[model samples]
Target chain A: MDEFSFIDSIKPDSYRQSSLIKGIDDDAAVFRQNTQDIVTAVDTMVDGIHFSRETMEPYSIGYRALAANLSDLAAMGAEPAFFMVSIVIPSDWAEQELQEVYRGMASLGDGYRMDMIGGDTVSGKEFAISITVFGYVERNKARYRTAALPGDILFVTGTLGDSRAGLECINKKIDNEYLIQRHCQPSPRITFAEQLSSFNRVALNDVSDGIASEGSEIAEASCVDLHIAYDSIPYHSSIAELFPNQYQEWILSGGEDFELLGTISEREWPEVQQKAEELNLSVTKIGYVSEARESKGLVYLTMDGRTERLEKSGYTHLQEGRD
Target chain B: MDEFSFIDSIKPDSYRQSSLIKGIDDDAAVFRQNTQDIVTAVDTMVDGIHFSRETMEPYSIGYRALAANLSDLAAMGAEPAFFMVSIVIPSDWAEQELQEVYRGMASLGDGYRMDMIGGDTVSGKEFAISITVFGYVERNKARYRTAALPGDILFVTGTLGDSRAGLECINKKIDNEYLIQRHCQPSPRITFAEQLSSFNRVALNDVSDGIASEGSEIAEASCVDLHIAYDSIPYHSSIAELFPNQYQEWILSGGEDFELLGTISEREWPEVQQKAEELNLSVTKIGYVSEARESKGLVYLTMDGRTERLEKSGYTHLQEGRD
Candidate 1:
């Protein structure tokens, strides 16, 4: 099919919002302005770099691609509203394969009531999917990396290192369905993040690049020091049992976890923990924000009574062995 | 440098709008809401498919990419606001070369007061740039393809087929500065489109896919027939002189002209014509809309007193002979 035909085929059967004035088949999509602030982020995934055909089906590739952007919106405590996807299709991909990719995105987007508005489709040598997601947050309430204050309690949602373990299982050809699922279908913390919006101030970052890098970003942006107890980091039990020696690296440097890492005032920690329990979501306090000393914006990890700088060791796709 | 550092390097020196709350170094960019409606569109350009590095320098590639998106906003009759760019960089692209791409985009965006907000940069096998641009229009004033009436006057801004002729010149290694510049930097009709928004209602589409294809879209969407007098279609004199025989195809089927193809009411045409003259813009009346007969919605072209169907023969990248 041609580009226009492909766009027509992938348009949602019905748009969810009345605010969406125009959708596909237009030069641009229009949305009626509301009182809420707008939050947006874009992410692109390419074949053999972000995912391979052997490691990921087209459906998972599409699902994970949208998931990455959703995770970013979640970090800002925004409600998912709309998205635009630009895909570069290689000659090898079939019509059914591309349909499955859109199906994957729709499946994830349906729960959040996000609508696919408009985007571009073009032919290329290799497959690539670039998605731009738009969400809404209350005025001046969107979370930011620069909001972390000294003496705040730093916390993370869910367990870490599971996605890396899942990738390892795939590469090693191990039979671990849970880990594989974690790697393929990451749930964005939209529900939990929406709850956190009630607080007056909070600093948030998504753990797409692992907590080490994310913590450093919050520290650097907020100009505060982050001190974490490495022992307090949570991991799925299977990760520790399957790869004990490498689990630490996976927890510290492995990326694509899609979990929220944030800091809230110490006084509000109890209420936030109670809300997490009510939502049945795991909220772990692994660290705290402190005043920066000579190293103004640094992250420190305390392990076995020894504290050292927590360098940025997050996973850099295609950079591991090539560099 | 890593992806993060590269993103840091390209952050705009300053954002133009106070409504832009958070820009780079954040999970997502946040924008304070205003009363105007928001319009957005995305376009992706892949290496060797859309434009080869041999023909398009890094700067032109970046500038043209943003131009393509800005043209979409102009078609919607919206004022440019903010944009996000997601790029996939191959290993061969140096940091300086990639920075030039951003500089090219910024140079054009500065004219319209557009700002670079947030986007993704990842490693890939082929270089690609995907940009999502957002603009604002007065409430209920954004143009649409379905707004054309049967008695409207079909029109186009500036000249057509120059960009395609420029591409031909590049491929043939011909020396024509004007044609080459046309291919490298075809300006969007943003200023004219903003003026058009003052009118009550008008149907609009950008001539990215040639006038035939763009006209057909308006005809099809508005459920009217477009009858064009071939003699009246505008083209740069250089195109007619250089490619005497192929000039018709360049005007009819060649793409990437970035001009505006629209229809305004017959009663409003004279006033609109006066406004175009005030701005020194060439607004040509090539045809008029008529009630669809048996064909429901179709485009017809009259040449030498003979009328025939104007089929969709617009250019499709990478589809010329590979099929």
Candidate 2:
């Protein structure tokens, strides 16, 4: 088949009418919207490293590739819009597999109104997916990492570490499908995060690298220290027995939870709490941001009122030699 | 590292700000321009299929990968503004090789103000690079493949078959450095291709899959057939005499020529000729779009006025067993 004919067979036009100015046979796909609070982020997933060959499903991988990118948009207090995907697949992959992969990509991609305007495909030894998403936020109300100030109340969306706990549950001879699903599927807080945009949000980050690591990133970026009341962190009632210790490890170090970690001013606490309710998300004011503290780390206040610095709990590249 | 600091390491501000919008930490890199004429294209080069470890310098491969994408923008008469790269390198590639690869990519990338907005990287068994470039033309004036009308003349830039000749020279006893350079460091006629956009006069595409093949693509896309004058097809003067029979084969089937092959109306031929001279490129009127007289295929006219159907010349995805 000819080049254009082969390209036509791919047919990436499901969500084209929403914002794409031009789809194919053009230099770049044009997307336009009036007024501007633009939010954009990029994420790529690869086989073997990010996903194991034994455990990875092609359809799920395709879905997760787009999911991770859109989630980044959601974390920024922005509504997702258009997205561009680039893929490299093994030449030996069957056409049926390629179609199924697209089916999975479109499943998630269409719901978010992400017009698959452009993409590239080529032969490679391993499969890789790279996605870039563009979103728009209200100009003055963009939740920013730099906005976090001292005395701001800290909060997280949803239950802490269920996704991580799910991983452990799967490993410990627990014949549970829920835990594996939790690790494979990531439904980030998009609607809930956007509602918090106008709450004078001081700092923001997606907990892709666990809440502890991302919280540290926010602190570093905003130049403020966080003192979280660890005991106050919400948890699922299922693992209520070891929930405290497990939650600390999972919520603090578990990557891929895709939960949002951000701070808001004390004055805006009531509004944030009300907004969280409307979104069906659990919003907890775990602690406060401090200008300086005895420990420049997470501070956990015991139920008895004693406070101590939290230990670093996150994946390091050097954990088992360089990754 | 800080988020911005991490971004800074990839593209310094002095270079990042060179484009219309800085890509670092922006919601979306703003691409402000007055013209609605836009051109966009994407291409990828894989390490084993496109370049082998023994024959290619990784840095040169990196530069060439980027150059090939820019060539597509040129074919559409677009000036490249920015690009995104997706790469997967083998585990064995040293950190310095990675830096050198970026050095080459950035060198070519920076020259065109194509900010490396973002990229995806992972460890793989082989090295691969995919790039998508954005360029602009006036809306109606942007060149396209289906623009060729009946009786429109065909023109191509530069000499054909040079890349194929170079490829042959690399695998043989041809002791010519010139051929090796042309094959390994094929120049993507960016400025020249962008210039063609200004004329905005006809169907165009870069000669990636040989002039004969890409010419047919334009004809087929436009739904008009073509009749070519075989004698008018230009050849690299240096290799024209050494192997006359093989020279024709290279000119006809040699891929990766990286020259522009396009169509123009009889009325626009004068402007096309003048622009060719201005750019110091060899512009040859090799064919004309027509309604097929005998069989429904592109025809090639010999110097004696005898005509026959054009043959497809270049790389094909179908393996021997598949056909």
Candidate 3:
């Protein structure tokens, strides 16, 4: 079969039963979400760079590609509407493996109610997956990172360093089931993150690279200093016990934990709690903020009964600063 | 450097200008195009599959990866906006070569005013690049393959099969300039293709995978027959001499031509001609559609003035279809 026919064959049919002039053909696939804000984001995942080349499964590749992108949509407090994916892999890759990746992605898409609109498949010198997610938020209702005020309380969803520590533990052949699961699939706190309502002047972001890195970014972007309480910071007990010397650093800097770090007003703290309980999400208040100038607009915190200057933690793609 | 650190080291400072509410550190990045009509597509390119690993430059790889995806956006009649690129390659690839690749992409992006939003970089078993493009067209100007109806005239933009023929000539070391140039950098017809208005119904699609295969798809999806007069087809003189025995077949089925095939009404024919001449675009009438029948569909008029059946003519990634 020709490549065109192959695309035509594998391309998923649109289940959308609305005014869709084109599903997948032409210069683009058109989607009309009447009177709705068009939310969009793009994510690309590389092979060994993002995942373990030694033992990672192809299905995990598909899942992570879509999950990582979808998590972006969630970070914006937007509902994922639709997405398109592009895949490039070696010519000799097993056809079944490709399908497995698609199946994993489609499963996540199903969970998020985001339709897989269309994508392209090609043979490349390496494996690369790119996903573009389209989502929607009410007019001006979407969240941002610059909204954190001086007194606002900072909180992160679920646990931190689990995924990062998981990778390390798994590498060492440690018999820790919880850590392994975290490394395998870190839950995206989409539901909890999106429930953050407007009017709270809430600043929102997800922790992928690491908590301290993302915290400082939000702080720097907002021109505020993140005042963290190390004791209040959440983590997996297994990680703490296994790597005592590195626990604090890993918890602060270890990346790839797809959790949410949001700031809400002190007045709305109770509401945040109520909403979390209502949504069945764990809302942990781990820190607060002070003057940007007081700390050079960086992350500082109280740890072990001392006012310790918290070093920037997390993966820094750049040489100078954290992500 | 660790694989993760390598990805980190390659981070560009312009990422801060992504205008994404929360980026890089989060599960996803978010942006709103503020346009109501959303159009999207994705394309992937593999190494040693789409290009010669030995002869092809890294910059060419980046340029073509983007050009191919942008061509898809153009075919949809959507204004090119933003794109996401994902690349997975062997870790041994020189850092400078990767820089050249990005430089080429950034140059194209600068010319097109398209943003390099986000993507993944991983070390893979093979080299692969996946790009997903998000664009928007005016609601009143949305075009689709299903929009084509009876009485519509099929049209093709530019000449066809030059890319394939050019590649063949290069592989054979044909002592020709045109063939090698065409193979190296086949220009995508982005500007002139939009002359075909959107108010007009079109079974329009790009000749990316090949005219025959894409044409067949337009016919198949629209549930109509594509009747092509082989003599009406346009071609480069070099291609005509390169594949003498199967020149027509190659043009019809050859992939990567990046020309466009679409249908327009007889009433719009005058305007199309005026615009084509204005834009210096070659607008060739290949065939017209006939009534849907039980068995008579996808017809081709031979050069000897004989009618014959046409098959899907394009490249497939399967090993058997490879050169």
Best by TM-score: 1
TM-score of each: 0.96, 0.84, 0.86
DockQ leader: 1
Q: How close is candidate 3 to the true structure, as a TM-score?
A: 0.86
What DockQ would candidate 2 receive versus the native complex? 0.34
Candidate 2 at residue A2, lDDT? 37
Model 1, range B31-88, lDDT digits (tens) per residue? Answer: 9757899999999999898888888888999999999999999999999999999999
* For model 3 chain A, the run of ten residues with the poorest summed lDDT: A314-323
The digit string of per-residue lDDT tens for model 3 on B67-167 reads: 77777876777766666667766767877787777776766666666666666675666667777776667775756666667778888888888877877
User: Mind giving the per-residue lDDT tens digits that candidate 2 earns over B1-323?
Assistant: 23333335556455443324335443234333444543455566777777766676767787878877777777766677677666676777766666677677788877877677655565677677777666665666666677888888888888888877876776675877777777777777777666666564677788777866786677666777877777888887876865665777677668788888888889888888887789887789987888755444453545445555565543232112123
Local distance difference test values of all predictions, in order: 0.89, 0.67, 0.70
How much lDDT does candidate 1 score? 0.89
**Each prediction's DockQ against the real complex:** 0.84, 0.34, 0.49
TM-score of chain A of each: 0.95, 0.84, 0.89
DockQ score for candidate 3:
0.49
**Residue B75 alpha-carbon offset, candidate 2, angstroms:** 2.6
Instruction: Kindly report which residue pairs in candidate 1 clash with one another.
Output: none
**On residues A248-294, what C-alpha lDDT tens digit does candidate 1 reach at each position?**
78887788989999999999999999989999999999999998875
